[model samples]
Target: MATLRGSLGEANLGRLVVLREAAGLVTDLVGSEQPVFAWLVHALGSPIVMGGQAQRTLYVADADLVPVGEVPEVRLRMIIEAQNETDFDAALAEAAAIIDVKQIDDKELASLLEKAAEQAFLAHSLALVATPVALREMGFRSMAGSEEALQFKRAHAGVELRIDATADWLANWRLTGISHSARHAQYSEKLLPNEVARGKVFLAVLQIWREAFGNAGMPECLELAVLYERHQASMNRIHVRRPVLTVDPKVFRAILRWMQEQEHKLLDPQGDVTLAFSDGLLRLATGNVAYGCAAWGDWVDDCVVVRQDLLALSGPLARARQIRIEQAADHLGINGLVLHRSPHSIVP
Candidate 1:
């Protein structure tokens, strides 16, 4: 009852046809002392990837039928049984012949051909599942699923960040979800753990702005509003009017450094700090920071706004827990083959 479908090109169609013919020959030699049957079984069990990067393994359950799905041009319905029963083949041939002789339109002919292709693809899939050796070769092994992941959350200001880790490997972890103020804009994105860590600096920038303006007021200047846009704390969420500002990335970094210094100056009640941008020039009100060029280029010293020590204080997410690999096998059913072990591990 398991049905699968995919595009079948001329090359794959030819392969399927040859495999079908080979199936009959293999079945005939199954009980014999012939080495050919064993070799055919091995060939059948050997994994063939069905799609591109997101490929599925081809399998054979028994000798009777093949499975199928959609194909682009010609639809082929094939039957490779050695027995005399040929009802399905005959029926398809008759339908095709009848359609051919009639004065059907191009669309109608195309529809019939597509239907045939679907059946052919379906037959191809069924034949693989019906082959006996595929299941025999699918021995038990380990796998990890989403349920096996370590899950945790962290809150910065009003944003709640959620992470999931499968193993100690950096690539094995991801920032899976986020929850922020409904009043602020929400973005749908998938981020690696490192990206999530980097996001903290942006979050800190937003925090500085919120502290300066308070929750009731928004920044009036385009410079700070652009910063909000970059930080994903968009002022547009609350219908605040601000000019669209696009500047060189180097200039943006220069502006960020100015903001960081502004935070420090705000700590001093006597310090006068003013921010303004005009004609590709940015200057702080207190005159301590200013950039005259469109490109600020490299920094003279590292402008590390969020200290590494402070970031480490945030700590790791929940420790990953080990679960039985059999769970993954059961989850995938017949679609996937479990190998010796998953190439992943958690430090904890």
Candidate 2:
């Protein structure tokens, strides 16, 4: 990624230069008395009505010059990095989308991103994660890394993600969450070339995130870094609390299948499997741990189907179950009997 130092305003230009230089990015005059590199703040750092590819979108910020000739009052700060120049170019375009946002630190920028993501997901019923460039355009400064997923919850959100509260908010907002936390951390580590063993350690800790969140385990440094990297790549290196809905039936089931394929290290040693169900009505609930969190989905049909699959399961446990599975309609409510083994059968 390329870091573009944009300085503006008559108030401060020296601080901007100093911060950029401190960041180890600088350019010199190629042979002219005036340096092309410092033109942003050199002549007189003032908020110019400058424009970019998008008309009237980019406005240089008000700035002040410091004693050390650095621009201290940098109204806007940003970080840019990309896998390649093409990625960087694509990112710049994304940044152009909201170039009008005023100066904001990474945290506020992250909140905006989470809100925007929540809105987008709600509007589309999809899980939409904000890209680094998207965050930058929203006035979020990048700290480090490129693939970090920013984390934060809506300030308006009454509940945190991963709990039933968060899930309920997503439903209320008509949004879907793409739970890439564990999966992304795992995928990111596998992409590393050297230190294969070390990479495994990274995933190992990430695998325990649920346990960590539940107050049962602690994540290691590699896991922390992986999450940190995600945050760094996010708006201002922050986490966005984006409300997301479940993936499509196919994808949701696949996610569960992938989880099931993994060893049961993430779950409590006592965690067991059973039928799951949900409606607008919350009658009986099985905590996430009880259902193994794998093979369980949130869609009413999927849950009812899975519930039936569990009830019909051919085992000693199946005969000894107590949860109610309704297959027929009654005066009370519509009930589903079959707990589906996989999500596909519920739809087709």
Candidate 3:
């Protein structure tokens, strides 16, 4: 996470580039033969050539280097405390006399080094497009949290959300007395947690939907229907022309905030509550209504029964119902409840 800064002379620029390029080539050549050296080049940082025949050792410099008497001063050395004389000799031999320190101006050297550092940073940023997970594992924590990473996530966010929502919809479909197929079940299982790795909101939404309605009436069903529609439109647009995939930062932030709010509401007692069993039916009371379903039957067997004064009381039912609905939509699952509230009507 440490930022690199330094200046290199114009005359030394060629030397630095040659050394870095040679180190890269050497790393590739001896990659299998010398895993440690390869790791030092890619994971740790470029190694510094030091010493002569008898005491030749490749020192992995942890910070920006400035040419000293003969070798650069090592600052905050890494824990990989082994010296590979053979690899060091090979790297030194490959990057031989690209430039002489005595001929380079000090100010130009500093400027060149600073430019080189910037170039290296750009290369690292580009590399993230290919090896994000690997780079992240190699102590590049700041890089993973960079705006570049956020942009990458945003690019695929829409597709990811759609896939997840579709899976949940299919799972909920089975609960509604629709014939269940193995394919539906498999897809639901596979796609359910796709976004959980990215953020907690995805998992939170899924859990709230599952526990509250068991795949029957979803409060957020309308929102998910809309999301799926938007997803289809996006896909269709891709067939005719390349559509830009960019998520507004403000939208992303708003989503996270909403999810956090839903999480808090779902955890409250009044938001969703299981009532005492009546006859052979299981009753769940939330918001301003009481819902009843057979203990063992398809979710389609569910019914919303009127609770005469349910809304009159100043209780958690309304808030709970709203939370359940929002969470259901947020998770992209099927919700059985009709969004409209009609106190005296029975919805079956």
Cα lDDT over the full model 2: 0.29
Tens digit of per-residue lDDT, candidate 1, span 89-126: 66678877887789778898899789877655333322
Tens digits of lDDT, candidate 3, 16-99: 211111111112222233322211221123343322223122222233333322212232122223334445676566434443
Q: List, in order, the clash count of every candidate structure.
A: 27, 50, 20
Off by over 4 Å in 1: 1-107, 110-246, 267-348
Candidate 2 per-residue C-alpha lDDT over 241-343 given as tens digits, one digit per residue, 9 for 90 to 100: 3221221333334334443544255443222233334432222222243322222223333232333333233342233223223332211112223342333
Q: After superposition, how far is residue 45 of candidate 2 from its true place, in Å?
A: 39
Write down the lDDT of every candidate, Cα atoms only. 0.32, 0.29, 0.30
Q: Give candidate 3 misplaced runs (Cα > 4 Å).
A: 1-96, 128-348
Taking all chains together, each candidate's TM-score versus the true structure is 0.17, 0.18, 0.18
Please, what's the RMSD in Å of model 3? 24.5
TM-score of model 1 (CA atoms): 0.17
**Candidate rank order under TM-score:** 3, 2, 1
